[model samples]
Target: MLNSINTNPGALLALQNLNATNTELSTTQGRINTGKKIANAKDNGAIWSMAKMQSASSQSLNAVKDSLQRGQSTIDVALAAGDTVTDLLMKMKEKALAASDTSLNTASLKALKSDFESLRDQIQKAADNATFNGISLANGKTAKLVFLANADGGSFTVNAQTLGLAGLGLSLTATFSTASDAKTMIAKITDALQTATNKLSSLGTSSVGLDTHLTFVGKLQDSLDAGVGNLVDADLAKESAKLQSLQTKQQLGVQALSIANQSPQTILSLFKG
Candidate 1:
């Protein structure tokens, strides 16, 4: 090889190799620092795009879970109101029976009537308080609670069962003026009790269904998150090993470049007078 400073092919080749090694080292260091193989679209276009899509899906599923929670709370409030109203109806029924008996005196009948009136009023109060997030499912304020299940326009709708006194056909506002009146109200109260019980059962089932759907959504989100991780998360162990190797190669590249640069000085040795 002729020692000529004007034409240094070895130096050019060594510089090119060093530049390549530096690029590899930079990439490996980025992976180590960020712990992501695809931090941007430039990393791996296809994998980064797929991971972003999965991340969006996971976020949507989380939103669905939140909706399910609100739906469940609304239904639960209605169910609790139905339970209270049902209990009140049972007490009212017993009061009606006691007042209807011929053996009961006028004062006894009046006392039973007063208790029955109070219990009946509580049913309305329970229905009023059953509202959740401004939704009165038990009192006929709304027809249903709709929860989004996914980003694909799917949903879960729970039909509201109005368990109010008017809803149960128990709107006899007049107090028991006589035994006959008390007897007449018993049948209606019995029906209302059964109706309220049925509504509670339905609401409970819907709440359980919502809970189940939330569980399913959580699992779906976990799967999507794992998919995103698989696509973009770096294997630190592998990256660390690569980092060590790149550091070694970077040093070797520097040494080789240094050796190539020194070749031009060798031409001076021929003229060393």
Candidate 2:
């Protein structure tokens, strides 16, 4: 309660409190604007670093997801082509059965032979065109696809199937010249159909496996994003409350400083004579 002309302790104390309140106000306002508690390394070095690392991990997983998608697409194209080839083989089997009846006339036999050859050529064409992203599973063009972006040992492997007619033991020069030839042709076509079916099944399995891996990676990326948010994101509700309280404290600080500044003037009244 002592007042001196040379020193003003009240003013000094009020100024100190005002500066502290201002600092808090500035920090609260920053959070409100940026919506982040740790906007930079200066805010919280340890937490910022951790969030940064997780963000990098999320990016890597995103790349893995992309690769998985591409691999799935490639497998899909191959499966479709294989299914068409299976259908073609079945038709060829019917033609072989018809041709086996040596009682048929020469004209009818030639027609059957032409129809069968056309189907065989179509199977080859289907295999050749079954490509996605410049990748073909049949024709032994590609064997496997791997997707793992991180340096750590984690990846999804998708296997390809060889459903090409040539791969299935279907020879281009194979012809049904006699009833005996027709019997042999039927067996070979059956075997090729079964082989293509097995390859299709394997491709389907690989597709499902890749899908499962992609789903898991999606969830993992989401978790990483949430973790980063927990480390750096601000609670706007909490910041709003602090902002109002600091504003009130600032007003009080100003009033206190005004009162202290007037104390020096009170010394003038004491000198009245």
Q: Which stretches of candidate 1 lie over 4 Å from their true place?
A: 172-175
* TM-score (C-alpha, index-matched) for candidate 1: 0.94
lDDT of 2 by residue, 1-273 (tens): 777988999999999999999999999999999999999999999999999999998877877888888888888899999989999999999999888898988888888888888988888888989999788887677777676633254777777677777778887876686766887899999999899998999889988888887788898899999999999999999999999999999999999999988889989998899
Q: Give the total clashing residue pairs for model 1.
A: 0
Per residue, candidate 1 scores C-alpha lDDT tens digits across 191-216 of 88788888888888888999998898
Worst 10 residues of 2 by lDDT: 144-153
Give the Cα lDDT of each candidate. Answer: 0.87, 0.87
If scored against the real structure, what TM-score would every candidate get? 0.94, 0.95
Best TM-score among the predictions, by candidate number: 2
